[model samples]
Target: MTDTAVAAPTVREVVAALDARYPRSWAEQWDRVGPVLGDFDLPVETVLCVVDCVPETVEEAVAAGAGLIVAHHPLLLKGVSSVAPDTYKGRIVHRLIKADVALYVAHTNADVASPGVSDALAARLDLVMLRPLVPAAAGSPAEGEGRGAGRVGELAAPMRLADLATFAAGRLPATAAGVRAAGDPDRLIRTLAVCGGAGDSFLRDATAVGADAYLCADLRHHPASEHLAAGGPALLDVAHWASERPWLDEVAGWLRAQFGVTALVSDLDTDPWTVHAVSSNKENHL
Candidate 1:
């Protein structure tokens, strides 16, 4: 008796699975999703999932012999006339091609997937009864029970606003910007809203839903202050990378189950902020 060999899937086959899971039509009009570069016919044995398609992740994928890199953020989001090696994004693109590593990006489309980025983040916090913070359009391709922009849910039990922030800091991946919260520290939080990436865009939506607190990344100072001043839910801002990194593991497990391939997550911290120091004005700890 002999055991059957595990089969590696071609780039096209894997791309089809990714697109089906996170439909390209769900992506924002200005966003890019799907395969960025790769030989569709080439077989991919290992896939590296990352939050960003930067030099560090590309290097990690190459060193690990990853045939394909599934990136949450697009390497080339804006228009560019040249991909000369001297340019930043160009260098990364060049490295991937040289090392025979194909690249795919699932940005906003992945965000809106039924069990997408925010779902992972919400899970990290042990939230329950999750629903979309911003539901998809009624007739859009993304329209469905689980398809939406962000997530709203209730913690297993209530905690103080400050404790909730600390709990989140501990739950999410470590980063220079761990977690920052703005609101009444002693306030009890139950219902919470979360968006994996930048979420200032949904502050009003969170408030509308009567969520006690909202957690996400990249909460700009102005928007955050105004939201709180307007009596919106408390805010917790984590590192942009830390917030979305959870989805990498979620998707990695998914790929393994769906395609039976070696899908790994890159732990490289690509959040840009390497050092963090708190104010000496008071004894502050997170």
Candidate 2:
């Protein structure tokens, strides 16, 4: 009997495909996206998908013998003086290089891709008629593909503001900061807007798009309160990590189906908040 070898995609090929799907040009001018570190010619057999490329996730990839890691967030978005391997980020870089693992980031580019971050989030809530909350500007790769920063859509059925918050809480990955909402709980919701991470910037866009309720993460005090005061849509805030984790599955599935690779999502929770305590005073405190 003759033996047949299964061919694997090279690091260059995988990064190319990712860039094609979520072009770097579509990302914000100040943002970093695309391949970060790796041997371009190395054959990639197994891939690990994660929301963040921290030390823990790097260890997970090394332990799994993953040739490549696709992360939603950048490992070194801010400028660093060096990769001395003693510092946290530096250690991650050295670890991956030693393990022969490559790291790629998809930040804002993935957020604006057609089946982007918020699309996965909306899928959890069973939203329909999905469209860009903030459509891309002219000449970008994602410009005319119904691709943009955040997403807006209609729910399968109308529900009260309270019910929608509860439903969203049940749908997203569990985090210490489970979920919180602001506005009249009894208000009805049919249209919804969602952004996967740190999406407070899109509050006005959600309102302009006529979303009855908006779901996202990292909602600060003044903007949230001012938006509500101005009669904006209802707001639902989830954990930053929880909001973006769903996209890992999407990318993992795509990698498997598209290239016949072994793609796995890391189960580690990267959200900073671990313990959430409820205030004893409840409504009386306010």
Candidate 3:
């Protein structure tokens, strides 16, 4: 008699498990979640996790031999009028389909989950006893009735703002841009608030919580200026993509341990802008 071993969970099954854990419906109304492509029946040999679904990240997924890519940000958030190759996002969509690579996003749902994006970020910075910063509004799941967003925590030892920034840049993926801060470099900080991406909206929460500093991404000029002027917490702005990249590793590790399937973390720097700055020495040399 020929023996035919039963197959384990396919890509679709794994995706379904993820969806059950973090329901797509729980995501913010504008978010684009769920599978982007590929057949559910196809066996998933390997998976890749990333922060963004940009062309570079897709390329990395292809190179990693990933059958599926689980990303933090949605590849298609808004309704697309067309899929012509002219547009950047369009081209990315085209490339993924051509490569037979599947995409799944867990945006705000993952953000609000316990031990989620914000929690991971806080852990990276060695923060302790983390709790919700904004403490999601009453009746919202994000209030930690089951989930929450934006974690606030205390540092094991308070450090100056500049020192904390240096620590963060070292712990996170090294980027040409490194880290940037807007506050008194010498200000000692203990209580800190962190949000994974585009966290300007939580400034008030951070201030109200009495956090000595707030770590997040996509801090606009006017808001940051106004917050500081209002005696708000010191702000440390990082690449939106970079700040959330650490969670990819955490997620990949979890999936690998949970399902026993090989998982890879995409190391693509999907941030659109590249840093180009001249040092004083370089200027003198020039």
Worst 10 residues of 1 by lDDT: 277-286
Which segments of model 2 are wrong by more than 4 Å?
2-4, 282-286
Q: Tell me the TM-score of each prediction against the true structure.
A: 0.96, 0.96, 0.90
Candidate 1, 1-286: lDDT as tens digits: 7979876999999999998888899999999889999888889999999999888888899988999999999888999999999999889889988888999999999999989999999999999999999999899989987889999999999999999999999999999889999999999999999998998889999999999999998899999999999999999999999999999999999999998999999999999999998666875768
Worst 10 residues of 3 by lDDT: 277-286
Measured on C-alpha atoms, candidate 2 has an lDDT of 0.93
Cα miss at 224, model 2 (Å)? Answer: 0.5
Q: Which lDDT tens digits does candidate 2 get at residues 1-286?
A: 7777769999999999998898898888888889999999999999999999998998899889899999999888999999997898989999999999999999999998889899999899999999999998887667887988889999999999999889998999998899999999999999999999999999999899988989999999999999999999999999999999999999999999989999999979999999999877656643
Cα deviation of 229, candidate 2, in Å: 0.7
Pairs of colliding residues, candidate 2 = none
